[model samples]
Every structure is written in structure tokens, then in C-alpha cells.
Target chain A: MKVLVIGAAGMVGRKLVAALLAAGQINDKAISSLTLADVVEPSGLGIDIAHTVIATDLSEEGAAASLIAERPDMIFHLAAIVSGEAEADFEKGYRINLDGTRALLESIRLASQSEPYCPRLVFTSSIAVFGEPLPAVIGDEFQQTPLTSYGTQKAICELLLSDYSRRGFVDGVGIRLPTIAVRPGKPNKAASGFFSGIIREPLAGLEAVLPVADTVRHWFASPRAAVGFLLHGAAMDTAQLGSQRNLSMPGLAVTVGEQIAALERVAGPKAVALIRREPDAVIADMVAGWPKAFEAKRARSMGFVGDASFDEIIEIHIADELSGKVAL
Target chain B: MKVLVIGAAGMVGRKLVAALLAAGQINDKAISSLTLADVVEPSGLGIDIAHTVIATDLSEEGAAASLIAERPDMIFHLAAIVSGEAEADFEKGYRINLDGTRALLESIRLASQSEPYCPRLVFTSSIAVFGEPLPAVIGDEFQQTPLTSYGTQKAICELLLSDYSRRGFVDGVGIRLPTIAVRPGKPNKAASGFFSGIIREPLAGLEAVLPVADTVRHWFASPRAAVGFLLHGAAMDTAQLGSQRNLSMPGLAVTVGEQIAALERVAGPKAVALIRREPDAVIADMVAGWPKAFEAKRARSMGFVGDASFDEIIEIHIADELSGKVAL
Candidate 1:
């Protein structure tokens, strides 16, 4: 299938692109082409197929129509303003996250009215669609009372995806991913970044700060699992989804202490020792209300699997980034 | 306590306005005025307060700002495109329900930020916010997975209300009202109208078509009960709401067969004989998937209540609408 990846420059997008290319499942002859778009051109997003890169800001009026002009069979919509940015910049957040998605969905609906085959849209949502005062383990049936602007935007998009899919405008699947841990990149502006930075930086033999207490528990899946979710969503039968189109993806729940222990086992005491605990009162208050775990029975039944342990996640990072070589 | 009611010409709004005037619960000296606005002037509303009437189309850009210029202490937002109209006309629905509500909220937010006192916003949401294939009985905790465009708009407004409330811009409460049964008026465009028309029309010795089977079930409250829900939402302490600001109001759930039986018992067998069982397959299919009952424990604990039974609901219609005159 010819595929288009929106937000192709982001961490999960990069992994999905690499996975798709490495597998050769979508061939140059059979799949034919790929189109990648983002606010920034997806530099270092190297793929040898007939690829077009569009650095279009989608919130502007008419950007959506232009993007959907050459409709691909599958569209991976991974674009969103991160949680902290969304909470801070109200108008920009809603403009990009809510309006942009609606514009794209509208364009897709318009195009598919004439075209025989509408594209399959795999939307990456987040666990943040849930809010405070959650059941100890959040189930698929939990009502979306998103506590943050970022979560609200994602939940709204999920609603739109279901409605559009029910209307037969397009086949869509929404995967509400847990926070991707050990995110392989430089520290970003996301409030959740500390969850990843603590591990990723230490693995790279750099000092990392833990902003919350060691006992602070949270849910996580590796970036590799997030990519797997996208592919799995693309391959699933739409008929099974019916009207309820979103699924809360499966992941492991562990505390900061557990994450440190896992890192020590995998990368030696020196790497773990590089981590310093200096709790920021602001971040501690924020993380205090975050969901600790999920009872993702729906996702499990639908065949979406995730990392069994944090060690496996670290190993995946090492094998991919360090070429299966590690220095302790 | 100055009050403004949008869609003041609509059924629930008219009732609520009447209730507010009749009760006169606000300190007479403190409450100087009330403002009622709609696309058409709200004539014969029978309110004694020093009130202003505005016939303005809220979809216009400056309408909300002008409406809020008086700076009412409380705003009751009841304006929306009903389900059928919204489903048929997507753009109009989005403009009126989504954009209109956003404009009003934005105006209120601006007013609050510029000055000291933010108005308390009492928004009338709907059970349409919950979609099917739902659980047999939905609870207050049920996630909003709206099956219709109107519902999607309500859900979006709920999110905005929550975000605005969280930021201390405005105190907002969204009440998800059940289908108001025994609506004393000519049949309107709402698909759920038949639920009320079947009983109300038949009680008046008029033949009414039952569009769905007797086995079909739904949740409902009397129009009087709806007024109570709105008033309680307005008067109750919102600080008790915590982060889950919106609530599903408690109502009775009954099957159509049971409703007819209740009508027959209250108004004699002749009223039941006046019911025509001409099932419209389209409406039947639509009604079949709707939530028949709700576990509104949160609202119940918070003191919102409804008629105990369909029989009681029928009596309410007679006592309230028919002015204590029951006809067999």
C-alpha cells in the first residue's frame, strides 16, 4: 500500500518509517511510493523509494486539501502539539491539534466521496485522554474526562475518527499509546520527557536528572512498540472495529526505582550511578496525578502486544542505536 | 445575580426562565436584571424581572461578545443544533453547536480575565454524549463516545468548559440531561421526539404513531425535571465537583411497552388504543442502539432527581402542563 506519514520527523514516526523500510513489506514496485509531511522537513528521514517531502503547516486553511490531493491508501497521522506546549499555549494548541486534525479529516471525507477507495487512517492518540481520579487500573471502558488540554485534543480527534469511520468516509484506527519510555533523542520540551531522559541519557553515559521520587509509578511502552501499534492498526480488519474505533494499547507499569534497577542490570552500575535524584516540586505535582497503569483488555484481545519489561526496552534501544555494542 | 439565557425561545429554555422567575431565589435587590437572547425574539415568556430581549444570530462573529457585554453574573447556555439537523447538515451543525458555543465561552473567558468576577456558566449537555454499542447500563463514569455530530459538539464544549474551569477563568457545570419526555408541543425534528409524542398526544385523545417496537427502551425525565436539573446545576456549589466537573443527571429508564402501559393505567385503556404501531424501520434501527438506562450515581448523590416511573412522569405532564386537569 502507498502510505503517507504525517509528523514524520517525530520520534515514533522515525521508528515507524525505518521499520516499514527495513521489513520491505511495502515494496517499491508493489507499494509504489511514500509521502512524508511535517512542520519541519523530515531531515535524516532517509528512504530510497519514490518519496515526496512536504513541510506544510496544516493548521492554515487549504493546507489539508493540498495534502490530500494525491491520496495515499494509508495515512499515519502522528502530528500533535505535545502536552506541556498545549497546556501553555492555548490557542496554538487547539489550532494545531484540534482544528488541523478536523481540517485533514474534512479533506479526506471530501476526496473519498468521488474516489473509489478511501485511505486507512492510523491515528496515534495517548493515554493522557484519561484524567485524574482514575480507577487504579484504567480499563478500555473508562470515560474520557481528559485533565489536560493535550488529552482533550486527542480525545476529540478520536471521536472524529470514529464518526468519520462510521460514516464510511475512511477506515480509521486510534491507538491510545502509553508514554513511550527511553525515547532515543535529545531532551525535548514535553513534561513527560523526564520519564525518558532519565534512562536514555544514562544509557548514553550522560548525567540524567530524576524530577520525581523513585517510588513514583507510571505506564510505559518503548518507541519500538509504538511503531508496532501503527503497523498492527494498519493491518487490522475495519469490520471488527465497528463504531467504537479507538483502543487503549497495552504496556508495562513500573516505578522510577524499577526503571533504575532495570538500567543497572542492563548497562552496569556506572550508568545507573550517573542518575541524580533532585525532585522538582512542579513536576512532582504534575506526575502525582498521572495514571499509573491500564487494564488494556480490549487492546490485548485485538492482538496489540508491548514490551514485557523495561530491560527488553533498553536492550532494543542498545541493539538499534549502539549496533549491539555496549560499553560499561 | 444577573442571568442571561441563550436559546430562550426553545422549550427547555422557556421552562427554565419561567422557573427562575417563579422561584425568585436570587436576592431581589442583588439581582437587577435578566437577559434572554435567541434567533427570534422571546415574546410572551412572562418574566417580571428588569429583562432585555435580543434577537441575534449567534453564529455571526461578534454576536457572543455583544451578548456578554452586559456582564451577567450567570449564563445558561442552551443553544445547539439538534441531532437530526446536525447529522444532515455537518457544516451548519459545527458552526452553530461547536463554533457558537466556543465563541460564547471565549467571550465569557475574556470577560473574566479582563475583570475580577467570572460568570458561573450552566451548560445544558445531553446524554447523546454517550454512544453505543454501550454497556447495558451506562454510569456517570462512562467515557463520551458520541455517535452523532450534535453529541460530538457537546463533548467538545464539555472539554472547553473543563479547561476554562481548571484555569479559574469561569466556573462551569455541564449537566447531561436525559430525553425530556412529554414535551408539550408539536412534533419537532428530533429523532427522539416520538418517545414523547407517543404518550403526550395519545393522552389528549389523539392517535400517535409508535415509530419503534414496544421492546425498545430509553432513558427519560419530564420537562419539569429538566428545569430542576438546570436550576440545581446553577445553584449547587461547584467546588464540590472536583475535576469531574460535568455530571449525568439521574432519570428513569423504561421500555416503550412499559411506557404505554403506564399511560394506559394513568389515562385509561383508551389512551393506549389511540397509539398506532406503525414502525418506521429507520427510526427503529436508530432507537435500538441508544442507551436505555444510566447509573447516574454522582448526580444522585449531588441531589439531582427525576420522576420515579413513567406513570409518575405522565402525572407530572398532567399536573404541570395540563394544570392539574387529567383527562381520560
Candidate 2:
């Protein structure tokens, strides 16, 4: 089996690559070759696998076609501009997020027409698809009324994924992942970056800004669990999905207080105290509209798993990102 | 105020044009000019309004841009291939329905860049946006999982409309019309054409085929009511719509038996006897997945009205299409 990972330079993508290498195979088939693609060449793996890293911008015309010409058995599409960036740069967002995704799908469709090709396509969507006026627990059948440009792009891609899959262009599964907690990297510009920073920073003996109150609740999953979702989605029985190919993945819904308690439990009060309370109304207002929780009954029933608590999430980060060790 | 009707040659479009002519004004402003555009030039309405009819395909490049350059104050986009046609001709369906609508929106957005140009964009969406595994009554916030290619296109367009509106690109309103019953013209190849055919043919003293069972329930509105919806959508205060611009319009939900009863009540048993029972498994299966009813609480609260009952629908057909007379 061959695998193609788009956005392979990103944090999740790098972790997913590591996970794939660790397993050595998917669905009992040895991954003979791997193609890691992004706008910049991904590096630092240094693994003994037949892999090629390519710097490619999919938004450019003919780029997607050229990439799909290789015809990997499974394609994990995780390429996208972050939410804050997309909202700030509208044209760039639509060009990269919407047109780029469509170009990829179209390229896949064209490729299938030339030869018998139906690859397992796993797309990473986001909970940003759900916006304000949300229910207490967003159900499996909640409507997607994204309030942000980034969310709109994701929602549109979800629609296309379902349509293309239904039309037999590709065997697609779109998983709307929860915000990755304890994201193993420096703080990014994403409004939800604080979700990870508040944990990652404190664990490294650094102060992290807390923009919102302790009551501010949100959904979360560890990078390891997100990788698990992609793998399971690729290997699972898509026949069980019916026509609705996109699903909101299950995650631990926790408030800031719960997260802090989990931090205290995992790394003691010293780590918890490192979180500096700095109320930023702009970020708070933005976070307020986000999805708090979801009754991801469909994905849960389909066997997609997530971390049970923030403590477990932190543990996964330590194991995966910190080599099972955290700085005191 | 100048008004542009994109699909002015079609059934509802023609009625909408007539309605506009009858009203002479919209939102207390006299319609100074009317531009009617379609694949075929619309004619025979020799009203004393400054109007121009053009045969144009919106899916063609530069067509929408040129039209938007004219800067019509109100743009009613009612053009689309019907459900059956779209399902059969996949590429053409997406080209005209999805790409064409997007082209128009993009053109409007581009036009806005030159100057402050936010026109009232009233788009005609459909009940096809909702598919099977449906609730007894689809509410204001139901997930759009369209089964057919046509439904998929409409659903995608709705998302784009909402996104564009939210971004302040255009003042847009998308009204999802119920199946227009007692259609004036001859039956087309649409799967839902039978809904109008049964009542329309019998009222004309001709035998009409009923493909689906009498128990099969579906939503309905008159051509007049559909015209009313477009006009109302064009003139209504969109600020009240907030971010969710698309809405399922209010309609009468009745079984085919109730429809027949209403037909009999309006035009006597002689007319009802003209209906032929033809069990078409193909159309029956197609009809099975259609929307039966809708809560449409949002649209109702927003003051978009529909016929009270099937009887009112029949009355509308007689009054609007049959010159207030039904063959008895």
C-alpha cells in the first residue's frame, strides 16, 4: 500500500507520519511508499522508509493533477490555512482552502476516468463548521452554519466530499476533529491556540496567557487521537457511512476550570499556577461562538475514539511529543 | 429601481416578472427598468415598462460579470436545471447550477469592489436540499444531506449564498420553495412534475397520471405563491435575517389523497375521475425521499407566506393560471 499525506509539514501531519511509520502498515498492508506534500518540503523524519517529500502548492493550477498522477492507495488531505489567517486574508483563504480542495477533487475525478482508481480519501475538517446559536450539545444531525470564512470553506469542502463520494469519484471520509489540546509546538495565531498553549507552556515551566474565563468550555482531542481518527477513518467500512460522509468526531468537552484541574492532577499545582489570567475580550468573543460540545453519536458508533479527559490528552502529548517526559 | 431576473423565461420566473409588472414598485420604489435573461429570450409580456429581454447562459464565462456590471438594484436568480435533469446530466448540472450561481455571486462581489454595490440578491433554492431519514417535520435548523445531484447543487449554492451575505458582499436571501403544485405549463421530465400534473391535467379536462401512491405526502405551494416568495425575499429587510440568510419557505403539506380531495372539491368528481392511477416504481422511489413537511418557523416569523391548504393551492391555480375558471 502507498500513502499520500498533504500538509505533511504541519504538527498533526508530522505526528500522523510518525504514527504511520510506527505501525509500519495500514489495514494489514505494508506501506511500500509514502509521499509527503505541502507548500514547503517536510523534513526531520529520517526514517528507513521509501518516502519522498515534495514542496507543492495545491492551489496552483495543474498541481493537484500532477500529484494525483502517482495514484496513492490512500490520501490524507489535512492542508488548510488556519482560521484566524483565513478570516484575515479572504482571497488567499478561498484560493487555498476552497479552490485548492476542489482542484484536488477534480483532479482525482479526472484520474479515475482515465483508469480504474478509487482511493480512500481521509479529509480533516474542523468543529469551526458549527457556529453561534448552537445547542447545549450539538447533535449528530446539527446543521452547519459556519460563522467564519474558514468555517465556510471547511463546510463547503464537507459538502463536496459527500457529493464526490456519493457520485463514486472517491471513497471519502471527512472527520471534523476537535481542537487539538496540548498541541506540541510554540503558540500559533489561531484563537484556539490558547487551548494548547495553556497546557504546553505551563508544563514547560513557562507562563501562558488565559484569554477567557474558567467557565469557557470547548471540545478537545490530543494529536495522537486525531491521528488515530485519520487512520481508522481510512481503514473503516465506508459502506456504514451511507451518503453522509462527513462526521463530527467524539472528544472530551471540558471547561477551562476542568482543564486546569486536569493540569494540576497531571503536573501538580506549580504547572497550573503558570497560567496567567489576562482577559482579552476580542479572543473571548471569538471563542464564545465556537462549539462547546458535540453528541458525536455517529462517529462514536463508527469506532472513532478520542481522549477521555484533558489529563489523558496531556499524557498523550507527553508520550508522543515529549518522549514520555515533561520538564518540571 | 432596476430589477434583473436571470431565469425569466421559466414558469415561476415569468410569473415573478408579471407580479413585478403588476406591483409597479418594490419596497416603495418604482421599478424603472427590468432585465430578463435566460437561455431563451422571454417574450409575449408587452407591458409598458422599460424592459430588455436577452438570451444568455449564465454558466458561460463573463456572462454573469457583464450582467452585474449593469448594476441592477435587485437581482432575482431563479435559474437552474430541474431535479431529474440535474441527476441525469451531472456535469451540466454542476456547471449551470453550482458554477453558474457562484459565478454570479463572484461577479456581484467584484462589482462591489469598484463602488458600494450591495444589491438585493433573491435566489431560489429548493426542498430537495433535504433528503431521506428525515424527521416528520423538518425544522428551521435541519441538516442538508441532499440525496440527488440536483439537491447537492442547491445545497452548495445555499452555503455560498450565506457565506457571501455574511461577508457583506451582497444582501442575499435564499428561499427554499416547496414543489409548485398545479403548474400552468405542460409536464416536464422532473420527478416531482407529477405533483402538478395530476391536478393540472384533470382541471384541463384531460387524463393525468399519478405515479406515486395516494398516501405519499409532500410539500406544496402555488406558482403565484412561489412568485410571492421571490418578490418578498427581494424586498424584505435582510438585517432581520442575521447570518443565516437561507430559509425554507412556508408551504401546505398534504398527502396525494388530500390533494385529490381538494381537486374534487374545486372542480367536482368528474375532474377527479380524469386522474389515472399509474404505479411508476422509478418515480415512487424518487418521491419517497422528498421532504414531506416543514416547521418553517423562521420563514413564517419572517412573514414569507404560502397557501393555507391544498384547496387554496387549487384555487390559486384556477385564479392565476386558468383565468379564475376550471373545466367542470
Candidate 3:
């Protein structure tokens, strides 16, 4: 099977590409060719299989058509303008996120007109699709009432995916992923950046800021598990999804306290001591409206797995990024 | 306040126009001008204050911009490619229903750029947004996993409305109308057309086909009540809506047997006898996936009302369509 991974330059995207190259197959079918695309050129890392990297803007006219011209059998769409950026710039957000996704779907549908083609499309959605006055644990049946522009874009894209799939233009599996923890890299300015920074910085024997109270709970999955979800979504029998093409992927629910406890268990108290407490009111107010957990019944039933616990999540980060050892 | 009705030729739109002209004001604000637009020119209808009608398609280039140029203070966007047509023609469905709505929104946002003009935008959505695996009664929080292309378009529009409102671009209120019962017109090819056909044809002293079983249940609101919902949606304080701009309007849930019983009570057995039962397996299968009832608590709390009962719904049709008497 040939595959195209859009948004292949980002952290998760790069990780997914590496994993795909390592496995060299999806659903037991060998990966014969790979096409990676993003706004900036993605590195194939000189992998052996037939590899190609292209830098393209999906919102640009004819960009999606060119990408869909060859029509790789499996497509992973992970590209998105992040939440803060989308919220800050409305038109840009709608252009890149909403229009970009629509362009891709339209191109695919148009491509299948002459030849009968239905590629397996795996779209990454976000928990931001659910907003304020949420339940303690949001069920799979909960409506998507997105409060932010970014969430709205993702929700709309999910709808398009379902409709396109229903029309038999594409075989789409949209997984609403949880917040990825222990995101390997420098601490970013995103409000949710603290979730990973607290764990990552401390593990690296560097001081990190804790902006909210320890009771600030959220749903989380390791980057490795996120990649696992994409693979499962790509390979799964979509007939099981029926009319509902989207699912909230399973994730471990934990609070700041739980994450700290896990860190203490894995590393010593000294490693945990690198944390600094500081309350940020703006972030707290925003996080108040965020989803803390999900039932994710459908995805779990479909064989998609999540991290066992925060300990496992931290361990995955340690093994993957830290060379199996915490700097502390 | 200047008003613009986008789908002014439709049944509800015409009634709303008549109601507006009769009252000569909305929410105690004197109407200054009226602009009625549709794919076909809507009659400015003779007895009116400053009126204009335009035959235009929203999907066309610069059409939405031209409409927004005048910047009417209140806008009623009731246009859509109906369900069956949309399902049959996929590209046309997206082009008109989805892209048209987006164009209107984009124009509104751009109109705001020169001078901040936030119009009262009352968008009409539908119950088709919900699908199968439904609970006995869907609540305000039920997920919208539409089984059809039309439903998907409405769901996406609803999300857009919410996001636009959240950004303060437009004061938008999207009401998901129940199936309008006893729709004052010829029965069309819509699978759900029978819902109105049974009530309408019987009252008109004509034979009507009942394609589904008497046990089949569905949600409905009278044309008068639907117009009432629209007017309320246009005038009500949107500040009360918060971030969730869309609502499932209150409707009477009745089984086909209940509709027959109500028909009998309203216009006697002779009128009820006009309904000929011919169970259609295709229609039965379609109706089975529709939403039966809703806990429209949000709309109800916001003072939007529904028909008192199925009898009231029938009476509404009789009084409004038959001049207070059944044709039978």
C-alpha cells in the first residue's frame, strides 16, 4: 500500500513517519511508497523505501488537486493551525484549517470521478470540539459545542469527513485525540504547553512552571500512543463505524497531582522538585472550559489503544526522547 | 430596523413576511425597509414599506457581498437545498447549502471591516442533524452524527454560526426547526413529506398517502409556530445565548396514530378517512433513523414556544390554511 502523510513536518507527524518507516506496513500490507507533505518541506530522513517530500499549502488553489493526483491508497491528515494561532487570527484559521481540509476532500472526490478510488483517510481532530459546562466525564454521545475558532474548524472538518465518507468518496476515520503529554521539545507559549512542560522539564533536571492548581485535570495520551491511534485508524475495518465516522480516542485521565505522583514514582523526589508553582489566571479560566476526560467507547471498541497511566506516558517520553534515562 | 429575508419565497419565509407586515414591527422596533431575496424573486409583496426583491444565488461570486452592501440590521437566512435533493446531488449540495452559507458569513464579516455592522442573523437549521442510536428523548447535549448530506451541511453551518457569534462578527441565532407539519403546499418528493401530507391532504378533502406505520413517531411544529420561532429568534436577546448560538426549537412529539386521533378530533372521521395507509419500506427505513423527540430546554427557557398539542398543530393548519375551517 502507498501512503501520503499531510502535515508531516510537525512533532507527531515526524514521529508517525518514522514509525511507519520502521513498520513498513499498515494492516499487514507492505508500504511500497511514501509521500510526505507540509507547509514547509518534511525530511524523509533518507529512508530506504520509495520516498518523496513536498512543501504545499492546501488552501492554495490547485494545491490539493496536485497532491491527490497520484492518489495514495492511505492518507493521514494531521495538519492544522494550532489553537492559540487560530483563535488569534480568524480568517487565517478558517483558511488553513477549514478550507484546507475541504480542499483536500474535494480534490479526493474529484479524483475518484473517472476512476473508482476510495483511500483510507485518517483525520486528527481535537478535544477542543467540546466546551463549557461539560460533564465530569464527557460521554461518547456528547454533542460538539466548540467554544473556540480552532475547535469549530475541527468540528466542521469532522462533519465534512463523515459526509464525504457517506458519499463513498473516501473511507474516513476521524479520531478526536487527547492532549499529547511529554511533548519532546522546547516549552511553547500555548496555554496547554504547561501540561507537557511540567513533566518534560522536570525530567530533564530543569525547572518548570506549574501555572494551575494540582486539581487541574485533563485527558492525555503519549505521542507514541497518538501514533498508534493513527495506525489503527488507517488499518481498521471502517464497516464497524457505520454512519458515525468520527470517534474520541481513549486517553488516560489524570490531574496535575497524579502526573506529579507518577513522576515521583519513576524518578526520585529531586526530579519532582524541579517544579515551580505559579498561578496564571487567564490560563486557569481557559482550562476551566476544557475537557478533562472522555468515555471514548467507540474508538476503544474498534481496537484503538491509549496509554495505561501517566507513569507509562512519562516512561514513553523517557524511553523515546531521553534514551531510556531521566537526566536527573 | 431594516430586514433582509434570504429565502423569502419559501412557505415559512412567506408567512414570516406576512406576519412582519401585519405587525409592522419586530420587538417594538418599527420596520423601516424590507429586502426579500431567493433563487427566484420573492414578491415584495405589494402591501409593504420600502421593499425590494432580488433573484440571485448565494453561491455565485460577489452575490453575498452585494446583499451585504446595504447591511440590513436584521437578516433571516432560511435558504437551503432540501434533504432529498442534497443526498442525490452531492457536489451541488456542498456548493449551494454549504458554500453559499459560508459566502454569506464571509461577506458579513467583511462588511464589518469598514464599519462594525453586526446584524441579527436568525438561521434556520433542522432536526435532520441527529441520526440513529438515539435515546428515547434526545437532550440539548446529544451529538449530531447526521446520517445524510443535508443534515451534515446544517450541522456544519450551526458550528460556523456559533463561532462567528463568539467572535462578535454577527449576532446569530440558529434554530433547528422541527419538521414543519401541515406545510401549506403541494406534497413534494421528500421522504418526510408524508408527515405533512397526512394532516394537509385530509383537511383539504383529498386523499393522502401514509407511507409509514401508525406507530412511527416524529417531532413536528406547525407552520405558524415555525414562523413564531423565527420571529422570536430574530428579536430575542442573543446575549442570553452565550457561546452556543444554535438551538433545537420546541416541538410536539407525536406518533402517526396520535396524528390520526388528532385529525379525527379536529375535522371528524370523514376527514381522517382521506389518509390512505401504504407502508413504504424505503421511507419507513429512512424515518426510523430520524429524531423522535428533543429536550429543547435551552430554547424553551429562552421563551421560544411550541404548539400546545397535535390537536393545536392541526388547528393551526386549519385556521391558517383553511380560513378557520377544514375543507372537509
Q: Pick the lDDT winner.
A: 3
Per residue, candidate 2 scores C-alpha lDDT tens digits across B63-182 of 999888789999999999988788788789989999999999999999988899999999999998888789989998889989988888998898889889998998999999998888
Clashing pairs in 3: none
Model 1, B60-139: lDDT tens digits are 98999999998888889998888899999888998998889889978887776767767889898999988887988997
lDDT of 2 at A181: 87
How high is the lDDT of residue B37 in model 3? 91
Model 1: per-residue lDDT, tens digit, A44-93? 86788778898987798898888888888888999988998898998888
Off by over 4 Å in 1: A24-29, A113-117, B27-30
Error of 1 at A44 (Å): 1.9
DockQ (0 to 1) for model 1? 0.76
Name the DockQ score for candidate 3: 0.92
Model 3 C-alpha lDDT per residue in residues B18-70, reported as the tens digit of each score: 98899899989998998899999997466547788989899999999999989
Q: Please, what is the TM-score per model? A: 0.96, 0.98, 0.99
Candidate 3 stretches greater than 4 Å from native: none
Which has the higher lDDT value, candidate number 1 or candidate number 3?
3
CA lDDT of every candidate: 0.86, 0.91, 0.93
Calculate each model's fnat, 2 decimals.
0.76, 0.65, 0.92
**What docking tier does model 3 reach?**
high
Docking class for model 1 is medium
